[model samples]
Target: MKARPAFMLVGAAALTLAMGACSSSGGGTGATTPAAAPTTAAAPTAVTLTVWGPQEDQVDSTSWLPKQEAAFEAAHPEYKITWKNAVVSEGDAGKTVQQDPSAAADVYMFANDQLGTLVQAHAIGQLPPDAVAQVKQQNSDVMVTSVTGSDGNIYGVPYTANTWFLYYNSSKFTADDVKNLDSMLSKGKVAFPIDNSWYLASFYVGNGGTLFGPKGTDETAGIAFTGTQASDVTKYLTGLVKNKNFVNDANGAGLAGLQNGTIDAYFSGSWDAANVKKALGANEGAAQPPSYTLNGSPVQMKAFAGSKAVAFNPNAKNPQAAAKFAAFLGSTAAQQAHYDMRGIIPSDKSLASSASITADPVAVAQMNTVANASTLQPTVAKMGNFWDPTASFGKALLSGDITAANAADKTAAWNTALNS
Candidate 1:
């Protein structure tokens, strides 16, 4: 999950009471009848649910967690809930929950990359039909895919997306110019973190390479980074590095360059929005990743995308309530509140389409990227083998050790390492 500052969240509650009086007359005109026997309605069910989320959300009584808890309580007056909240960051929720499923929070937030682990441990429950419909209806396909297990079941409700997009200086490149990376490079200095494995695969992915499977879940399929297309991408990167307008962002070079005005554009995610805004001021422009020309055709650069989502523990005492609350946390209204209160960009499509979200370029670009120009980062355990080897290849590219002459050989070796 992105490291963000905490915000205050206040919950509003509304209750309605209905009153009625009844009387009956035995005779038409003269006789008065006794009132109907007094009756009492059944009491609401009492449910105690333990919820967990990042410390940022639980920082105070007015934070996102408390506000949502209060709202859930108000929304469902059928259940009188006693809330127990703990500080467990989304990134660590799966591991912690797996340690003791019986002791885990009934409902919790987690990064989508942990879905497989949670599924393997049977710690996360499959969303109910209503919740499943909401998840598909409210979110983009990528957000929906992120929380889906290998067995094709929806496991959670996604709230915010995790992905990178293009941040540029509007003064240097127009909207048309931003459509193609080569165009941006020709116009002004551009920085890309080719040496980082996280950003390195964008080019290859754009040129028809894939991780795991098309959806990134078929472990037997492995990585598809060899063959002609992958080699072509390698050759393209070789030339891209030699371009005077291109700068390989290593360490903090990209942001540093943007800060110093040496860089006109860089590739990054929402986490860098504030810093990029501060650096560019009036000229800041954000957009989905641009395409690069491959073998004379334009291919869209696709980043690895995932989501931060809410899930219920199947083993919880009140599984139904836990599931309902989990769905509520990722609901459209809840996501809108999350964005408003915490500046957390929402993954919910309704909120993404709202005027409030569209006004923010970073938020718009992120949603656009996730919806149109990104691949799902798979949660399979073998995905663990991908990083170190890809990073090594990226380093080699940055070092200029793999030129067009050796791009094919080097590319083949990288593919081998990925599968190995």
Candidate 2:
């Protein structure tokens, strides 16, 4: 679990009022009995909060979930919390909650890509003002947008970002050579997952194609993968597929090739860091996505960026407490704890300069890509219709079904199918 929750509160005025009430209760009579020791300041409120996350985070007593829950309890002495935790991956949260929001965990983890679905189902709660401020303060703009609902409200607290970047063999190419796809291909073999829809869009996006709208939030704008700019990218990819040094990564071929010394560079997120390190050893290198020349001009390839976030159920029995716990799970301190315990990179900007994060190449690459080379993977419900069509289009390109002669027609068809 990369995401941790945070809840910071202010009660100075309340404390003052409480002190005033206590003083007045004594009535200046100076009761020697001490008035029963101030009646124990009223027992803390009792609350039951159900939490959901992947089993990996709670497989043992020493796991991240139990440790975090214990910390939440200790920090919040205002409540005696009874925790009921269930196994639920962030990827499955939206569908599970939609099945029965009322029965959903009070505080749960979810991928930000599911924000629209969760919002449409009325299962996810919008963040309170304090939490909203915390989210903005802790994350990059791209990460903040990843958890924003269509209504322009922030819906969750992000603890870790999700995005891909370039990983390469530093022994084969200089740092400058890796900055451009053409430069890398000219130097050594490069494996790219062009057949995967999630990875395929970078080429077209690097040119001028847009998903949804310029910011990816306008559902009606649709995917703008048409026109000359998009077709030019398609034509470029047609030539790219025929290049001797270019390998179409499929079925884990990219990572396998790297291990066997057949591939010098690949594209992936931090999830593959350990494997990459094992494959390249001292030669391992990571960077944000590179530019590829199109029409004799440099264009930057951008990946789809999102986050894994903690959200509270709007229908929870203890709504306020649930929301607070969700916020706590994404706090800076919690993010730090998550990273230390599970090796999950924190999304909090305050940790960017920390020794642990700065020392890790994969972490630096992922954070830099999110902040500079990626666009928010839209949370709009319409985005559900995108994957298959683009994927089929990528397959067609890889199979020679799409080429210079048919690039325009195929590109236009892809755009139409996407809108349909």
Candidate 3:
């Protein structure tokens, strides 16, 4: 794990309180020994900082979050920790915090895609120069890129590199067998949530479709949803939906099917890796999602890559304490704790390739996917338009609504949606 050098804590008063004691009873010899006067160290001023995250992290006593809180308090004796259970996700932070900045948690874990909005709303504050340098030195470039604002300021420390890849029952599919989606579908059931826009963006991306241009900051450039490349992928998806092996597992139906043995393979990220592995047992294996044939050429399927980051609230009652704790939460030890406790994939390069992460199929799949083949989820507000359109396009494709004759109309509607 990467060494997370935190703030320099000063506790001279606490150390001085450790004075020695003398025998008060004189070994019961009836000689009264005068008790030494007790020395009390001046108490440090207490500062309470509020934090937020998923329910599991907030509620589980054995979870790493509480452990992190304890350790943070131990390091900074003057500050105390208070956790608030909130479902506010990264995408929700901007609008929600903008409504009531004082109500927002001091330090919260949010997705990378919402960084732009958070910065726009002024909900999150910029990282100090040293913390920014530490984040860059510790995490991958892709991760660092996600949290950086358009102004080129670092806003948060990333905790997990979130992305999807291929997972198959190793006992049923060989390494080569897992390389092609066509082959995997031919073997039987494979759960791919075609209705999900997050996953659908991958096909468009794989087919050379760009969303909000390369860096994801160009709103006027819009997205690519009506081109020939899109038609190729859509047509490809249309064929697969009719295949008996295809299963539309939106809203976790795919994962459930995989666990219940009705599905042979699943396309998802690290969050579902542990449960899916439990379902597959020794047969569990994972790799990057396989390619599909498009116009006689194989098109590599891409995934919407993202990260879970810790952002310090600008309205924090204790900005200094919040910043210090935010650094602690993203520290290498906390990342490893998250894995050990919740099996979350680590973003730090040290923990990303560690034995614990590398040995696990889920973590390995994510690491390989992010490093080799994945498209960054655009962080601009315009990205909100891409999700529904991609999902609707997938829904139409699955329904066989995009035949050659109707492809133009469907493409126009999809493009209109994208432009909206």
How well does each candidate superpose onto the true structure, as a TM-score?
0.90, 0.87, 0.78
Cα lDDT of model 3 by residue, 22-54, tens digit? 223445444334434445555665676777777
RMSD of each: 9.2, 8.2, 10.5
lDDT rank order: 1, 2, 3
What lDDT tens digits, residue by residue, belong to model 2 across residues 1-420? 232223211344455566666666847553232212222455789999999999889998899989989998999899899999999999999899999999989999999888888998999999999999999999888898889888899999999989999999999988899889999999899999887888888888877789998878999898898889999999999999999999999988889999999999999888899999999999999999999998898999989989999999999988999999999999988898888888888989899888888988888888788877888887677787889998898888889999999899999999899888
Poorest stretch of ten by lDDT in candidate 2? 30-39
- Rank order (by TM-score, best first): 1, 2, 3
For residues 1-420, write the lDDT of model 1, one tens digit per residue: 333223311111111111111113333344334434335566789999999999989899999889999999999988989999999999999899999988999999999999988998999999999999999998877788899999999999999999999999999999899999999999999999887888888888888898888888888899999888899999999999989999988777889998998999999999999999899998899999999998899999999999999999999999999999999999999999999998899988777769889899999999999888999887888889989999989889878899899999999999999999
Task: Write down the RMSD of candidate 2 (Cα, Å).
Answer: 8.2
Give the higher-lDDT candidate: 1 or 2. Answer: 1
> In model 2, which regions exceed 4 Å deviation?
1-40
What's model 1's overall lDDT? 0.89
lDDT of 3: 0.77
